[model samples]
Each structure stands twice: as structure tokens, then as C-alpha cells.
Target chain A: MSAVMAESCLTRNEWICGEYLRTRSEELTDATVEHVTITLVAIALALLVAFPLALLARRWRLAAGPILSLTTVLYTVPSLAMYALLLPVFGISVSVVVCGLVLYSLTILVRNIMTGLDSVPDEAREAARGMGYGCARLLFGVELPLALPSLMAGVRIATVSAVSLTTVGAIVDHGGLGNLIYTGMDSYFKAQVLTASVLCVLLAIAADVLLLGAQRLLTPWTRAGRRAGRRRTAGIPRDSVMDAPGTVV
Target chain B: MGVLPDTWTWLTTAEHWSGDGGVWARLSEHLYLTGVCLALACAIALPLAMWLGHGGGRRFGGALAINISNAGRAVPTFAVLVLLSLGPLGDHGDLPTIVALVLFAVPPLLTNAYVGLSEADKDVVEAARGMGMSRRQLLARVEVPLAFPLIMTGVRTAAVQVVATATLAALAAGGGLGRIITAGFATYDTAQVVAGAVVVAVLALLVEGVLALAQRLFDPGHHRRRALAAAPATAVPARTAP
Candidate 1:
């Protein structure tokens, strides 16, 4: 509270204080690492669960409605509600947040994965079958590769969303930078609040750019001039990702 | 006490339904905040995006606006909520929550509204122009009407999100059903928290359903054909260079 200290934005608790960033770099880094870890794990988990579920929906046809409806319902659930609903099962661990994110993301992932599979040309599937390819071979070799663009699109949305939602995990004490944010909120620490939130946004945008790059690498045929097999045209535009309740259509 | 029956009892209790802290009070607060935020978002985003989409140097400027708004999606709702509440814009009260939610809601509105307007059947737009319709006439008579569904989709999307995240307003001393959840968290009352979650989820889904129904019922898609069921831009013969 000295005059000299008050002259600094950090001691004055002002936002945009570079001093806070310098002094709290370690804490910030740790929170960021935790945030990134939670996001990666949730996206990976959701993909694992979603592929089987998407296949089931595609296979049974009848199961498709219920699977989609359930995921959409899950998407509609507020993050707070979703977290609370899971706390009983996961019991105050980061898993509760991860579980909630995975469920929340299912709507987007399953829909995109389904769309990807459907976009695979019947001729390709028929040709694979004509060549004596079995169901697994057709799915693994022919359909999935063709479905890459859409699937990658789904992953990008789900990943961005997971990054954003991970902050809410702070309520339970595991929210990485979310912890700093909430603590800052409680204490009215302007620098912590502003810094943590900016980092979270930067993290989300960075994840999105990274995924877009990954999509390009994975599906090189989709490179600019070719534009042959990218099949994201059916539902709502994919341009608006993050926090969107996927294709309510 | 949060076992199924306990939550049932908690919901049924008169005490939980009728005070400043009651479900009814908080629900209204939540709804009021949601209503105001959605209206503000629509007012700001729809006009600006539509103008940009219609003609305002729509090629470069429109894309820039759309890209900027789309980038807006990367900003987390919670962070904005907390930042506004705790940062320079607000020290306390609903100002932060309102500002944050409006900002959170604008991007979808902008993206959808612009897409809806710009992507309105190009033929219909041209026909309207051919008929000597002024730009205003074409936009109002042809474009806005055509874009209604997508525009409303934006509204619905924004509304559901506001309902879901408005609960976070509780963190900022703003009133909303989120208070119910936070209060339960504060007290470690499992049943109360469970009840709050159930209500918020129901509200969000209900908003989504109602809006979907409205979009279906109200969209006057009179002259607009789905246009050869045009598959996305993928099939459109590449635009010949000017």
C-alpha cells in the first residue's frame, strides 16, 4: 500500500498489469498446463465414446434418434447443471468435468462423425465390397479416410468447447486457470481475473488454429485447389463453432 | 439427502419456491436477464451483419465482419462474465452479467444473420431487384423474409446459451436460477443443487424446443425454393474469375 507500490498496476490490483504476469508466471503456466491436459483428455475420451455411439446410431437407424436426442439434451444442460449431475458419480474430481464435457460434446462429435460416414460415396463402399473387402475393412480403409474432413471438423469444435468449459471446473477446485479466475473473483483481484480469462481465450483460439492445421495435414486432398472430398455442407454452417449446440436441425 | 426422493421433497417444499431466494424469484430473474440480453444481441448484431451482408462492401468488409464475429466465438462465456463483472466495465451488480451475456450472444446472431441474408436465394434477390425494387425493398421484402429461419435460428441458439450460462451470473452478484445451484454449492446441500440443475436444464431445452417450433411455424418461405436442394458450395461449379 506504499506510494511506490500503488504506482504499479499490480499492487493497485489494476487489470493489464505486466508485473502480475511476470511475477505469477509459474502459477499461470501450471494452470494453463492443467487446462490443456483436461481439454485433451476430454476430447480424446469423447471421441472414443462417440465413434462407437455414432456407429450404433448409423447401424441400427432406430437408435439414431435416441442417441442424438440424448446428446442434444446433454448439450442443453448448463455446464453447472451438467457438473452437478456428474459430481455424484465422479465425486469432486476432474473426471466429473471431463465426463460432463465428453457428454456435452457428444452431440457435435456424433453428428459430425455420422455426417462424415454418410458423406462417403455409395460407389466407394460398393467398390470396396466388390473387391472382397469385409465390413471392418470398408469402414477402416475406405469410409473413415473419406470421412476424415468432417470428423476433424467435429474434433475441432469439441476441442474448442472443451477448452472453454474446463474453466468451470474451478468451482470444484480443479479448474486450472479457472481456479485462479474464481479465486481472483472472490478476492476482487483485477489482475488475476483479467490475465486468467485472456489466457483461457487465447488457449481456445490456439486450439482451434492447431486443429485446423491438423485437419489440413490429415486430409491433404482437401488442400485449396483440389477441394474434392470435404463434405460439411448439409447442416448449419460449420464456420460458427465453440459453444454452439451442434446442428439443432 | 439428494437421493431421488430427497430432491423431490426439496422441489415440493413451499419455502424453496417463494422468496427473494426462491425458485420463482430466481427463475424470473434468469428469464428477465435472458430476455434483455437476447433482445440487445439481436438489435446490435442483426442490423449490422445484415447491412454488411446485403451490400456494404459485402465482399471484403462482410467477410471481415463475419470473421471477426466468428472469432468472437473463441471467447469463453464464463471468462467474459467474470471479466466484465470484475474488470473495468463493472465493479458489481448486473452490468457485468448483462454486458458479458450480450457479448457472448452476439457472435451467433451475427454469423447466422449475415449468412441468412447473404445466402438468401440469389435468384430471389435478383428477381426482386429486376422488379424495380429498391435496395431497401429487396432487403426487406425479399432478403429479410428469406433469412427469417436462419436469423431465428441465431436467436434460438443465443437464447438457449444465455439461459444455460446466465446461471453463472450468480457468481457476479447478479440474480438468476444459477443462484440456486451456487447456493446449494455454498451450503453443500446435494438435493438443492440437484434440483437447481434439473430446473436449469429443463429451461434451456424448453427454450430450444419452443424456438424451433416457432421457426418452423413462422418462416414464410413462400417464393424461396430449397434451390435444387443445392448441396453445399462444394457442388456449385467454381465461380469463373471476373
Candidate 2:
């Protein structure tokens, strides 16, 4: 298939079928996997840092402002410049790419985590405390669960941004789908470019859909509300269990 | 010891400021290119956003717009430049570069416009309708004015983004401040690169400041305040109905 595609690419002035197939089958799969892995690692690192910082920020408002502002400044620094600055210190390796990616993720992740923590209803915390729940137990059992949806939304945004920005890594001789894009540009191969572009879009959409589904699954109470509403409108007898608003604890 | 040629030499040289390759001449071309691209983006995105915001259609279209914008945000400016240059439009002067920048500029403009128009006070829109204003009139007279501030935020963002991204036009052999950056990169001239980066950043800041002023000036609430303060002094009845 690769040989055939190479032949067709040579013969055709426009993008050829075999070349498209070969590029997608041979080059794209490995590159996309690598990109996805790198992005996921970066997001994981961001979450590790951001979640604790968010908890700290919640405890200390003054700290949150400066930290968030610093992240915002980092966000404005252009992607290429960030990569260029890092290259000298970290070299053109996955470490530098990950550093840039993690730094970029901080702005989104911190905002998301802080908002999630702030949004946890005060009444829920009071009820949990009334039930004699400890801080660690309350946070894990109540607050984090309640804030999961918002936190996931932030993760969704961060993940998509990471996926896109990782393409800049291609400039530093790193291998990824961005390599295909850069190659297509350098060689003026439209099919290669379009195929890679389409793949990136698809990857973003797929990731979003999966995250959304996970959010829905983790927050069954929201779904339960819709179901209960439907049952009430249909004149079904509401069970006392369903009638009671579940306490956070 | 020096990075490259002196900055003043490049700036003051008459030959460098003349004809096709002159610095001033190139700057003018860059401005024209940037202006045309931004105008085209705003023109296309503004109406689309207004219509979408007005709830003329299902949100599926809005979702599509959001997705496309996200994609646009994801793709690096240089990557887009290269793709456009190679596809259909090859490195042929300003057209491809403009197209790329327009793509870059459109998303934020469209998203903000749609959000702003849609979020305008429903009561005000209803009042405008009660006054027997047509849909077009309501949009033109009420919605657009009210939404202008938020729309300007999008425009401000797009301006900064376009100006910064426009520097990539140099990669396509299109003349712009990017030419200096790319040239500097090629010749290993750190000063030239720094100069280009400085000028582009300054231009971005200036554009941002102008847009910020425009936002402040067009804020409907600001006008309302002035009107309230001036009301007692004027003999004419203030028109505050709708």
C-alpha cells in the first residue's frame, strides 16, 4: 500500500487515494497515539498540581488571584515563543514539549478547579458537618463529587487545547501528527495535510464526547431528576425515596 | 558584539523605505493585508453571529461554529498558512495569507457576537417589539447597540490574534513584519528578530488599546448615565420609553 501510494503521489499533481490511505494507515496511527499519550500525561500532571492548588486557593483567596494571574500571563505568551524558550534549556525532546503543555494547561485547569470548589453549595458543606463528617471525608464524599461536572468541563477544555498546541512540538523535530502536518507543508502535499487536519478535528470531537459521557455517568442525580420529572408529569406515584432530596453526605 | 545591522540604519535608510522592498513600503502592504483580512472576517462573522444569536435556527449550527472555531484555535497559525498556501492557493502574494488570518480572526468574533446578541435583555427586545418595531429595526436599533460592547471584546481579541498571527505571512513569502522575523531567523540576526517581535507586540498592544476605547465609548450604559445627568437641564422630554 505504501509503495502504491508513493507511486500515485509521484504521478498525480493533486492528492491521490493510495497516498492518502498510506499516510493514514502507516504514518498517522503512530503519530496520533504519541500525541494523545503526551497530551494525557500533561493533563494528568496539570490536574495533580491544579487540584491541590485549588484547595489551597479556596483556603486563601489572596493566593488564588496571583496564581491565576500568573497562569493567564503564561497563556498569552505565544506557543512558538514558549517552545523556543524551552528548547534551549530542555532540548527538543518530550520533556520540553510536556513542560510547555503543562504550563499551558495550568491556566485552564486552575480556573476550572477553583470554580468547581467555589461552586460547591455551602448548605451541602454545613449538612455534611452537621452529620459529623470530617474535612477529608466531606471533601472526598461530598464536595469533589458535586464539583465533578464542572471540573470535567475544565478538563475537556484543557485536553482539547493540549491536543491542538502539541502540534507546535512538530517544529522542534519531535514526532507526532504535527510531523505529518509539517511534512505536508514542506512537501506541499495537500492530501497529507488535509488528512492530518481532519484527524485532529476528529480526535478533539471524540475526546469531548467521551468526557461528556463520563460526566453524565458520574452525575446520575442529574439524570434522575429528569426521570423523576417525567414520572411526575405522567401521574405516577412518587416514592418517598425519590421525593427526598438526597443530602450531600 | 552586535546582533546585526543597527536598528536606526534599518529604520532611517531611504532605500530601505522605498519601492517594493523598502521597509515603509512593506509596512504599508502589511497594513493593507491585515486590514482587508480583519474586515472580511468581521463582515462575515457579525451577520452570522447575529442571526444565530437571535435563535433563528437550532443550536446545532452554533455547535458547528464552535467546533470549527476550536479547530481554528488548535491549528497553529503557521500550519494554517502552509496548508492554505499549498492547497488551491499557493504562495501567491497576499491572498492565501489573508485567507488564513481571516480564519484565525473569525471564530472569536463570531462566538462573542452570537453570545452577546443572544444574551441581550429579553425584556428590552420585547419592549421594542411592543413599540411595533420590525425585526430588522429591533436588531439594528436595540440588539446591535446593546450587544456592541461584548462584540467589541471579541473584535479586540481577534485584532490581537490577527496582528500576532499575521506575522506568519512572511512564511508564505508575503510581505509583513513577519518578513523581518523570518529573514532574521534565516540570517541568524538576533536584533532583527527582536525588532520585528517588538514592533508586532507594540502593534498588537496599540490595537488592543484602541478597541478598548471603542468598547468604553459604545457602552450603552455610559450613554444612559450622561443622559440622566443632562436630563434636568434640558426642556425637551427625554425619550426613555423603550
Candidate 3:
């Protein structure tokens, strides 16, 4: 059954690729690059908007709850609906794509930033203030650096989610990896579909690993826990593994 | 009414609720699709998560499992639905749709379960073992129960995702609330779109509320009124001594 399916997909691809392999490959590569670039830009925009607002929200509980809740509500709206809503205002262009992706990233980003900032021990803040550091200086000098790990966690989640949602923009002729999936689906081209699907899955994995590596490089604190986790697992029995400290029970 | 002209007409239409089928029938089908997909996801992901969590010296394998799940998370549901439909799975009615939904749901469930179980308290596990509990007993009685809250968090996230993504099933000829939204979009019928959107949002909220209640029931500490009933007598004393 697997062989037959593979043969059928290959035959279908051969039929579609009659004389356009070069062109199609170029298109596919271009789509992948375009998707990545647009998604990164959206995430950057989200971080810019969300980080400050999240910090401000932390200081004032009144602002924090409503802002965070609003972002959560926005997050719940489906990507398709968000794109459709944007079309009227931004039209079928990069603007619509960017707006949709950025909005989606905000909820995760804001929540993470706020949580990270709040995670900074209160005593640290008091000490900074006692030393004559102003609020802005304290936030920039003390809070931000300590909050890096949590902030990166949010960024990682946002980036992956953005990459996934970028495919949806294909519905409006905004070319991306999703466009490849869409074309394959419309024409019932199995090989094209499979290739695109496999690439997407790989892209997600690669992006995640890269982000994880980046997290380790930037946040040294987590490295000890990760290393400890590794040592505890090495040569350990399955049952003994659970007894390792910091292993979630 | 004036502001939402499209939504106003849709709310008044017979087709919105009862042209070919009654409201109950339409809703039942939608709920059915959502329920089956979520259930299948839970069945697959729960065990997978448990195995990965318990599987030691296999951190690389665990990371691979998580990476696979993260990949699933990154693929848009509609794109997966399209891929499955165009592939060999197309021969099965709504099978592709269910498969895509399951794929979509699995990542969160598996990741959360593994993370939750792996994060289980070490002292608790030691205590259970010191008390002479077997590996199976430790897992079943202590680890799983303690991990329940985090597992529920994964389920909650997965549930919301499934509810929202199931709308794409309409594109694959599987009946769900998405059909209305898609149809509404094609014809520029804002009312139909509004009706569908409203129903889906309400359905999502309903599911969330039900799950929230379930979570509260499962979590003894969530119910403020039951605080006195659920707390162990030694907790306060233990904290005070420290």
C-alpha cells in the first residue's frame, strides 16, 4: 500500500512537472523565504508593541488586566477570520498579512513579558530603588535582564505560531509556504502536497531547535537545569528518573 | 441593528436555523465532529505522553517526540486538512478531516502531558517509593494525579484549538459550523457569516465553560468554598514550622 501510494504520487508529480521543474523549484524557494521574512517582521512588530505595554501593565494593575484580557480575546479569533477582517482595511497585501500575524503574536508575547517581569523578585526592585535607580532605569537595567528567559520563552512560542499562521495568508494570494500547500490541494497533486507538508513540518522543527539553542546561549541559568536533567537521566532506571529534583511530579 | 445590517438579517432567516435541517441537527453534527476529533486526540496523545514521560535515558527520543509535536503545531490545520484530502486518506469520508484535527490536537496534549509528568515533584516520588510503592503505583497514584492540573491545561488548550480548527472541516465536505462561515464568505452574505461566527464563538465559550467547571471539580483548591473541606490538617502546621 505504501509503495503504491508513493508511485501514484510520483506519477502525479511527473505529470505536473512536464517542463517546469526549474521554475517550480524557484517558486517554492521564494515562497519559503517570503513566508519566513514576513513572519519575522510581524513578530518583531509584536515584540515592540507588546513589551512596553506589558511592562506598563505590570506597574498598574488596572491597565494590565484589561490589556492582557483584550489580547487573549484577540488571540482566540481564528486566523482566517482575522485575515478576512483585515482585507477590508488593509487589502490583499503584506500589510494584511503582517497585521494578522502580529495581532496573533501579541497575546503570547504580552503574557510572557508580563509574567517574566513579575517573576523578578520584589526585593530586587526595592533594592534598585533604594540605590536611587529611577523606574525607567530600573526596568531597563535590572528587570529586563532578569526577565530575559521568560521573555525568550514568549518569543519562541510567538515565532512558531507566526510561522504556522503565515500559511493561512495564502487564502488571499499572499504567497508563502501555505501557497504551495494550497496549490497542491487545488490541483490534487499529491507529490507537491507531500513535499510542501514535509517542508513545513521540518521548518517548524528547525525553527524550534534554533530558538531553543538561542535560549540556551542567551540564558545561562537554564543550562544548569538542562545539564542536571541530562545527568539524572543517564544510566538511570525509568523509575529512578522521576526522583530527580526539579522533575515535575 | 443599523450597525450590523448583515448580522440582523441572518439572525431572522429560516435558513439560518431551519431550511433543510433543524437547528438541533446542525448543532449536533458540529458538536459530533468536535467531540470525535478531541476524543481521538486524547486517546493517542495521553499514552504517547505517558510513555515519553516515563521513558528515561531517552531524553533525545523525548526531544524528538516534542519536536514532532512542535512541527504539528506549526502546520496550519487547513493546510493539513488539504494535504490529507489530496493524499491516500481522501478515500475515507471525513477520515482526513478527523486525522487533521487529531494531528492538530495531539501536539499540545502530548507536550503538556510529558512536561507535566516530567515536572512531577521529586520529593513526592521519593516519598511514594520510600513508602514501598511500586513503579506502577508511583505513576498511577502519585505522578498522574499530581500532573493532572497541567494535563488539564494542555487539554484546555487543545480543546479550544480543536473547536476553532474544526471549522475547516467544512472545506473537506465534513459538516460543521464552518460550512456556514465558508458559504457566507463565498456569496458575500455577511449575515450568514455573522451567524456562523456567532455560533462557533458561542460553542467555543460553552466548551470552555464546561471544561473550566471540570477543572475546578478536579482541582480541590480551585473551589474557594471547599478550601476548608479539602485542606489536610498538617499543611498549615508544616508551613508554620518552616
Candidate 4:
């Protein structure tokens, strides 16, 4: 589209141009940083909030119905709607994006947390009781460790989703790569749009793979149990529960 | 509270419901885009995934197809829509958006269809085969029926996601209810933005509820599942959150 067409891919506005990277290195780096920061912060906040909510649901069965339903309904709200719903209170800030993500993450995080807690075999609790371990010790030492795989799996799903969702934040002027992608699309900046999008995807995959490795490292016994060939997955944490209703919206 | 009353007024105003950017037009656009993408996705994914699930899963081609579909889910819909609209397909109105959305919607259907059939009862499949049923007959009479519930679930999930993403896609030169919200933003019409969001949310939930009803009504073993759910001996205590 430009007069300097003979220069190279940059002049040609090619989608796969490498010059976009050379010219926009700092810009890409800044967006990537913001994206990663928001994603990690949202997930951490969600985990902090969801664990107690899950425990509350477990401890008080009466509250379980309402707590679970509320989150599920929240999940059903589209992210765009969720953000728009939140913007009134947060006043068009990054908090709106983060809060929206945390709310969205709750349905999965809370459900998975409860599932992990529920899956702790009664016999293990009994054995811990037999050992004279106190309630706190029992929860932290036995229960949480046993539930690590499920909890980690939930975090993995939540993180990947958060990365995808952070792109939607661009509408609010904070969506890391999303900002680049949207602006690029406006002027038909092919290289910028493609590069930013590819970067966004790579970010999600990287987050997922990182979490998977962390799950393995933390739940070593899952691997050990599998290796020992004891009942073929009875003792192992099934992080393979990919039945997560991946609303990539 | 400030935004709420204005939003109510915005929604209540008949003028807001009939114009170019009105709720009716944007909504019809949203639904039209959603329906077309869903139909295309199902057309491309269901039969292939089902076939792979029935008799081809162990082969490399089948696995490759399944993996590719699953991998497609990781690409953000916003990015896809933007790039697609800006690409060679730019001049074709709604074509780029439809292509992006259809690509977006396929993965869930494929995975669900394939997984559902693969999970068909091996014992029941064998019994059907022993009764001298041909492979095609066994897949049709046994496997497909068994997997019907899950396939329906896949459809529900996909529809809901498409609706939500379509709303966002409108921000990046795409169309739908999202356009109303984006337009509201452009004009600093807070009430319109909030009202538009409310309508989109309601639409998403409506689609979800209707599909869930369909899943329940159309499932082949819906009665059996209901019976089992009612049976005390086999009944589980707590609900499994999706």
C-alpha cells in the first residue's frame, strides 16, 4: 500500500513480516508484560477467594446450593457482558477486568476445589485421626496433598482461560496483546495483528504447559503411584480431567 | 444504581429497539451469525468426529484430527476475527466473521462427539455385534444413541460460547449485540452499553436453557438416566459442577 514497496516485507505490510518485531520490540514486550501480570494476578486472587468459598460450601451444605449456583450463573454471563456489568462499579479501570476474570474463574475454581476435597478417601481421614493429627494438620498435610492434583488442574484451566480473557480487556484499553491486535486490525496492519495474536496463543499454551509441569512436580506421588502399578490410577491424581467447559469467549 | 435506572429506560424505550443500531436489528444479526456458524461447525465436525469415535480412533489420522480440533480452541476468538476481517476476506461482509466464528465453534463439537462415541459401552457394543449386527448398524443403533447425550452437551457449550464471543467480536469490526455495546461506548451512552450487555447476557442464558432442555428431551437414554438419578442405591449425593 505504500510507495516504498520494493523495500521488503515491512513495506509490503506482509502478515509474516519480521520487521514488525524489530521495530516494535518494546511495544510487544510491554503488552506481554501487562498480559502476563494481569493473568497471574487474577488467578492468584481467584484461588485465594475460591478455596474458602469451596470449603464453606463443604462445611455448610445448606450454603452449597446457592454458592454453587451463583458462580455457575456468573460463568454463563459472557465475558464482554461481565466486564460491562463490572465497569459501572470499577469505573473503566484495570480492576474491572481483574474482578471480572476472578468472578469468571470462580465457577471452575470453586467446583474443582470442592471436588478435590470430596475425593479425599474417608479411610485417609480415619488414618490421620488414628495418628492423632489435629484438624489443621489433617487438612494441610493429608487432605490438601491428596487434593493437589485436582486443585492444580483447576488452576491450570483458570490460568489458560485468564490469558485468553485478558485479550477482551483491550476494549477497556488494558488488553495486552489484545490492544495491539485490535488497533492493528483497525488499520489492517497485518503484521501487527498476526504477531500479537500468535503471541497471545503462545502465552496461553505456555501458561498451560507451565502449570502442567508444576502439577507434576507438586504431585510426585501421582507419578509414583502410576509407576508402582497400584490399581492403575486409583491413587493417582487425575489431572487429565479435561472435561472443563472451555468457554474460550 | 445510577446506571441501572438509565439502563431500564434505555431498554424500555421503543425507539432504541427498532433503529439501525437498535436491539431488534443487532439481535437478529447476532442470532443469524450464531445460527450459521453453529450449523457449519456441526456439519464439519459431528460426522467426522463420530466416525472417528466409532471405528477410527486408534489410527493416527483420527487422533490427528481430534488433536487439531482441540488445539483450535486455544486461539482467541477476538484475534481470529480481527485477523480474518483484515485478511483477504475483508471485503466480504460478515464472511470473515462467520469463518472465524465457525472455526471457533468446531473444537467443542469435535471433541465431544469423538469422546462420546469412544466412551460407548464396550459390553453393549459387543452384545450388539454378537446379535449379528453389521458394523454400520452397530454404530447407528448402539454407539450413536449412547453418545447422543454428550454430543448434545457439546452443542450446548458451543452455542453459548459463540454467542458470547460474537458479542466481543463486534468490537473488532465484527457484528452482533456487541456492536450495540461498542456503539454505546463510542457515544458515551452508559445506559445503552449496560442495556446492551443485559440483553446479550439474557440471550446467552436463554440459549443455554433451551439447549439444556433439548439435551434432556432428545437424549436417547434420558429416561434411564432419570431412573438412575432417582434410584437411591445408585444415586450420588452432591451435584458435579460442570
lDDT of each: 0.80, 0.70, 0.71, 0.83
lDDT of 3 by residue, A1-249 (tens): 777656653554642442244546887788888888888899999999998888778667689889977776677666665665565556458888899888878887787787678678878888998999996899899888888877787777677777777777775667488788777777767666666666666776678779879878877876787777895644322211121110000
Stretches of candidate 4 above 4 Å error? A1-8, A228-243, B61-70, B228-242
Backbone clash numbers for all candidates listed: 1, 1, 7, 0
lDDT of 2 by residue, A1-249 (tens): 877655675447465455466646967788889888988899999999888888877777788788886776566554544554455456557887788888878877777766667678888988999999998999899999988867887787777777777766675656367778777877777777767766776776788778879989999887877776875533212211111111000
Cand. 4 TM to true fold: 0.93
**Candidate 4 global CA lDDT score:** 0.83
Docking class of 4: medium
Model 2: clashing residue pairs?
B16-B23
lDDT for A81 (candidate 1):
85
**Which structure is stronger by lDDT: 1 or 4?**
4
Clashing pairs in 1: A170-A175
User: What tens-digit string does per-residue lDDT give for candidate 4 at B1-242?
Assistant: 68998999999999999988788999999999999999999999888786677765545434555555446646777888888788788898989888878887877787777777777889999999999999889988999999998788779888988898789878877778998888887788888878988999999989989998988888889898888877777545554421
DockQ of every predicted complex: 0.39, 0.16, 0.31, 0.56
Expressed as tens digits, the lDDT of each residue in B17-97 for candidate 3 is 875444456678778877998899999998878877875533654675556554665666766788777767888888888
- Across A15-54, the per-residue lDDT of candidate 4 in tens digits comes to 9987789989999999999999998889999999999999
lDDT measured at residue A68 in model 3 versus the true structure, 0 to 100: 78
Model with the higher TM-score, candidate 1 or 3:
1
Please list the residue runs of candidate 3 whose C-alpha ends up more than 4 Å from where it truly belongs after superposition. A1-11, A14-21, A85-94, A121-132, A202-249, B1-3, B20-26, B54-65, B122-140, B220-242
Better of 1 and 2 by TM-score: 1
